[model samples]
Target chain A: MRLLLTSATSEFGRTVADLLSGDHEMVLTDQTRHAEGHPDVVACDLGDDDSTDRLVAGIDAIVHIGHGGHFSSASDLLDVNTRCTYNLLTAVRNAGINRVVNLSTLRLLDDYPEHLTVTENWRPTPGVEPVILSAHLNEYVCREFGREGGIKIANLRLGFPLVAGNTAAAAASGESAALAGDDLLTAINAALTADLGVNAQSTDAPHPVSFRTVHVQSPFENGRFLLKGAASILGLWEGQGVA
Target chain B: MKILILGGNGMLGPWVVDALGDRHQLRITDIGEPPETTHEWRQIDVSSLDDVVDAAEGMDAIINLSVLRPHRKIAFDVNTRGNYNMMVAAVTHNIQRVINTGPHYQLAGPSYEDWDFDLNPDMPPQPGTRLYAHTKALGQEIDRVFTTKHDVYLQTLLFYHLYDPGDIGNGPGGSGVESLGKDMMTPYSIAWPDAGEAIRCAVELPLERLPSRAETYMVFADVPHSKFNNSKARGQLGWQPRYHLESLWNKR
Candidate 1:
């Protein structure tokens, strides 16, 4: 499939680009304007109409791994995450691109200090604290796009991305190395090839909505996938009947 | 057998009634008569422990889907006191399952800046704001106590938004209809369906296999950016959701 991979300059994006390049035609872009080794890079600012328009034309699928800092002001955060996503999806629909892989953070699920292993069915209790609530808003936008567009949307939430060989500092800094590029590649590959029907809705055969949310995390070697991103990849793979 | 539902007229109670109604003996009680169909109806204030006990007697399963009224005192009364009363009644009555509605806040808390970790069902309840959320947290705590002390199966479902095409015009009161649609379908809202599936699993799964504290499930489509997890529900309980937000909303 022809792919548009955003955030190509980020560490994880670079890894995914390298992994997928051998088998797929990849078009990479980022707000940074310059990606070191990628020659087909484009400067697409999600905030700009022209940039969104350019990215949406002719791409079969989008790996929207783009994100900015969380703003203290709720409105600013919404503008950046929620509205920015809205612009992209609208552009994608207009351009007739129906498949997307939305890269989301696990923080959207963190509602308390007691630690919760959230499932896709949990709904944000309105009036939540701003930061987490804003993230939830971003998640909501993605699903809405899928519902309205009938686009095949895959949301992969990563915990702290593990930078290879950065264990000591990574641990002390509380950064997760789990969401690294290679880790994402596993999920991306599975999504690319997997059937979504099985994972798209319950096996009980309910009619699917325009959207689906699959957890992608590293699977436990025992054949169980946990770690957000791996689970989604496996579920997508299982849904698709891909080996 | 005999099933009792607190706030039986609310969002999920009606569905639970439909799913289990024909199979088991069902009795429903709520403060107001909910619009849907059900087997039996009794008027009861869930906030009052006395009323809860009276209604809970002679039921196999007690499903509570009432939203705590926003008044701090009332919210506290119904959510905290009323929840405790329901737990005690279940224990006393030997109800097979106690399914209470839980929201996303049970897993997602105030400390997070953005998505990072998939909600782990094994994680303990987190800190939250709002009297309603506070009460829900308390209900989970009470459930934990009952789960251990009485061997009663206590399940809390952190439900997602239930939207109908008809609701789009008026929206959810304060929010505009268009914005409500935009907000409800987001990736973070994925847990909406898992809430129902969690309830289903709670009733279907054997008590011996349930988690010690509480469990959460996601019930929406597989969106790429979501932070919830459904591994335990799928792997442990072998359960899955039967509906997605759009289908659920549009179908009925």
Candidate 2:
């Protein structure tokens, strides 16, 4: 399948691009024009309506991995992040793209009990933190679009993506917050191809699309996060491809 | 200055009346009868637009302390719609300043069980699983919208845990004192007097000193390992909470 990966320059996007290059046709785009080294990446700002429209055309699926980081001012965070998601999803709907995979953060569940293990069924507490709130709003936007009938959304609420050089060490150390790059790729691939069933009695369309929020984290002993559903749903297991 | 307080019969109302009653011309309103206080009192429900307009006339500013319990129909009506009503009335009646009170459920804390960070006031609201958090967040959003459109200055003061001084000595096993030592909400506690003083500062702060037409501040006592940052309250309002939760434990 043809895939459009947003924020292809970021660590998450770059790793995804590297892993999925052989299996599928990938078009990578980012706001910053840093495509000199990489010939396949196309520089496109998701916040720009025209740019989003142009990039989403003929794309079979979207892997939304772009967001202003946690340190952005509240105004910029809300305006840019929400606008990007809104613009991208709207354009995707118009383009008749059915599959959307959004990269949400585990921080959305940051307010849950520290001792309790979190799962996909855990509801997000998107309190006043700008980044977490924006992530929740992003998921809400995806769900709204999915409810509109033709779109199938898989929102991966991933833990901290492991850094480039030290992922193996981090995974070996059993850091609860770390998610290996290979595990992220496997989750994304599952989201893109998983048969998430159907919503037969949808209000907007006779066959409403399926929207699922899955938690993605590397296996850690006595970790605070539960990965039971991710193993079953995304076909990912702990230490799946670690060298 | 003539200040109209909606929901003045709430838990924090009497203290607020005591804090500012000596200086400001205070008019207290709530659905219940006014508590025995020196200030003028009236029975007014904020959910009613006309009722709010009637009470808001001739007031220089308004302080909205009204809160709705979750799982009730009035939670949305009073918390969300009531806030909208208060803003409309404030604008219609030419009230220049409005102080709104909400809980700190919007911040990452006990309700968010997984969030383990010291949050500042500037952080966006989370509004976890609780209906009250969502409604209060909607109210703050309404405040933002109205402040942008109208000439009103709005301050949303989000409070954490509130406790009365008298209740501090009630021992650990009392009905409301059960959660005193609970890690989730212990350090975030605020005294009634401090809450009142914070409200007073929100009311009296000069409009020129305000950074924006709409601002939010987290009001709570200084606690060790506090999840909330109250620097906005300190820098902008020149307010500091005098009471600490540690003092309560120490006294007990």
Model 1 C-alpha lDDT per residue in residues B91-125, reported as the tens digit of each score: 77777688777666654554331445676556655
After superposing candidate 1 on the true structure, give the runs of residues whose Cα lies further than 4 Å from its correct spot: A1-243, B34-38, B113-115, B165-185, B190-198, B211-214, B244-252
- For candidate 1 chain A, the 10 contiguous residues with the lowest summed lDDT are A217-226
Q: Write the per-residue lDDT of candidate 2 for residues B1-252, one digit (tens) a residue.
A: 999999999888888998999989999999997698878888988877789989999999999999987543466567766776888889899888999988877544343435555677776555642457655665676566678668999998888678875565432422334335566666467878889998888888999988889888888877677556777888899898776666434424
Q: What fnat does each of the candidate structures reach?
A: 0.00, 0.00
Candidate 2 lDDT at B61 equals: 93
True contacts kept of 2: 0.00
Per DockQ, the best of the predicted structures is 2
Overall local distance difference test of candidate 2: 0.72
